[model samples]
Target: MGDLAAVVAARGVPAQEVMDEYARTLDRLVDPVRHPSLCWLRESGRLGTPDEPDHDFRFGLERVLDGVEALARGASA
Candidate 1:
């Protein structure tokens, strides 16, 4: 996730309060009727916060490694 790293590097870490304010703004802006999918995402609480900078990167890397390991196991078998 080079893009994620780049964004984090460029912006640095944002304050939790600032992020919370942005989340609130998003809540207000996303109309349930007009953007049902976005509304669902907003309500789902899956929109991760910026508390941990490397969380998403680490998660993606772990999933990729898991897939590679599975493929290796299949090939050996």
Candidate 2:
């Protein structure tokens, strides 16, 4: 989930766009394919592929969200 989020986020895509892209990625994964991915792959303007997997991405995402939560709380206080 977060991997997908990171993809759209990295692309300078908005949160809502990221969500829509994520859903489509999931839908694409859900169907019959040679490889089912939890994350969507982007070219990154490079010819190489990413070495990390979806788990690594989501791990960072959880931390990112946690940080956001903390920031929000601090701002509220």
Candidate 3:
């Protein structure tokens, strides 16, 4: 999600107009059958709210750490 981080860092929370354009683009391009998970996420009404920019990064970081821990454990075993 480095690209996401870069966008958040550069924009610092998108304006309403930007959010509207993003939504329109998603609506136009995101196909439910082709992009089911992305479509679900788009429909969930949780996109474009980057007020706490680090939230997603931290979440992803923790998951990465968890995977590393599991790998370390397996290596030890």
lDDT of 3 by residue, 21-59 (tens): 677799999889999999888788777544365776798
Q: After superposition, how far is residue 58 of candidate 1 from its true place, in Å?
A: 0.4
Q: Every model's Cα RMSD, please?
A: 4.8, 13.5, 3.6
> Who wins the lDDT comparison?
3
Q: Which stretches of candidate 2 lie over 4 Å from their true place?
A: 1-52
lDDT of 1 by residue, 1-77 (tens): 45444555677754444556667988888888999998787677656355466777789899999999999999999
C-alpha lDDT score of every prediction, in listed order: 0.72, 0.57, 0.75
Query: Which pairs of residues have clashing backbones in candidate 3?
Result: none
TM-score of candidate 1 relative to the true fold: 0.46
Task: Point out the worst 10-residue segment of candidate 1 by lDDT.
Answer: 1-10
lDDT of 3 at 39: 87
The deviation in Å at residue 12 for candidate 2 is 34
Candidate 2 lDDT by residue in tens digits, 1-77: 45645676679766556555545565555543543342333222221323334756677799999999999999999
Question: lDDT of model 2 at residue 58?
Answer: 79
User: Comparing candidate 1 with candidate 3, which one achieves the higher TM-score?
Assistant: 3
